[model samples]
Target: MSDVIRASAAPKPVGTYPHARRVGDLLFLSGIGPRDPATNAIPGNEYFADGRVRSYDITTQTQAVFANVRAVLEASGACWEDLVDVTVYLTDMARDFKAYNAVWAEYFPDIDTAPCRTTLGITALPTPIAIELKCTAVVRADNRQD
Candidate 1:
């Protein structure tokens, strides 16, 4: 059976979607952004008068996005080590890649055990955040038919 999952600890999804869905042994996460869960504020971000983003700290966004993904995994009875794949989106690759990658290194630490990852540059996200993550993990061991 498949189960839809929502994480109260993660930022609420901007649109109509659950945080993740469990299909048998796999947990598929939605695009997780860096919005603060309680305040809904974008960290390390400055806005223009019209609410457009003026400046953002990619390092902060990257760190928060990873935390958001972790929250979803934990909510779905999974763990960080259970991650098998990740897709990263960045608004500006050339400017942000180094900082983002550095924070990623801190989180993963070991290349051999890290999840397989692919990163892409995109024009924009729905919000003013600079980074977002979509992930898939092996939740088979905790497969208790949620």
Candidate 2:
């Protein structure tokens, strides 16, 4: 049976959806951004008077997003190493890819063990955050009896 999962430590989803879902041995996470759960504020981002993003630090957002992804994984009885694939969305690829890649390497250090990833440059997102991550991971049966 499949299960839906929500993580209290992660930011609340903007729409009507759980933080993640599990089916068999695989867990799928909704697109996760760098917004703090307690404050709903996007880290490293500054907004203009009109609410548009004035500037952002890709390194900060990347770190925060990774932490958010980790929260959902733990809530689903999985862990960082279980992540098998990741899809990253960036609003500005040309200017931010290097910083983002640096942060990614900090987390995934070894290429052989790192989850396969595909990054895309998108025009915009629902929020003003510059980056978002969609991830899928394996759930080891040993950590859960569900």
Candidate 3:
């Protein structure tokens, strides 16, 4: 059986989907961005008056995106170490990969234990935000009932 997971501490999903879904021992997270749940704000996003993205700070946005992911993991009774894989989406890889990688290192310091990752350069995202994260984590032993 599978269960949908929602984290009130994270921004409500922009579309009709739960923050994550768990099946067996794995939790599959939806793509999460940098928007704040309480304020509906993107920390590092800068936009033009015409609603086009002018620029964004990759470091700050990466932090917020990870924070949101952390909230979802915690709500699901998991943690960073439980993460097994991740898919990263970036609107501008040439402009942002260095900053994003630096911030990512802070969370997963050791390469051996870090979750496997794949990053893609995309034209745009659902929001004006620059980056998004989708991940899979193993449910903690305590949270599992067989």
| lDDT (10s digit) by residue, model 2, range 26-129 | 99999999999999999999889998778899999999999999999999999999999999999999999999999999899999999999999999989989
Give the alpha carbon lDDT tens digit for every residue of 1-146 in model 3. Answer: 89889999999999999999999889999999999999998997788999776777889999999999999999988898899999999999999999999999989999999999999999999888999999999997786634
Model 3 earns a TM-score of: 0.94
Candidate 1: regions farther than 4 A off: 142-146
Q: Native-vs-model 2 lDDT?
A: 0.94
Supply every candidate's count of residue pairs whose N, Cα or C atoms clash at under 3 angstroms.
0, 0, 0
Candidate 1 per-residue C-alpha lDDT over 34-125 given as tens digits, one digit per residue, 9 for 90 to 100: 99999999999998999877899999888888888999998999999999999999999999999999999999999999999999999999
Where is model 2 more than 4 Å wrong at Cα? none
Displacement of residue 102 (Cα, Å) in model 1 is: 0.6
Model 2, position 86, has a per-residue lDDT of 100
Cα deviation of 41 in candidate 1 (Å)?
Answer: 0.5
* Whole-model lDDT per candidate: 0.92, 0.94, 0.92
Worst 10 residues of 2 by lDDT: 137-146
- What stretches of model 3 exceed 4 Å from their correct place? none
Quote each prediction's TM-score: 0.94, 0.97, 0.94
Winner by lDDT between candidate 2 and candidate 1 = 2
Candidate whose TM-score is highest: 2
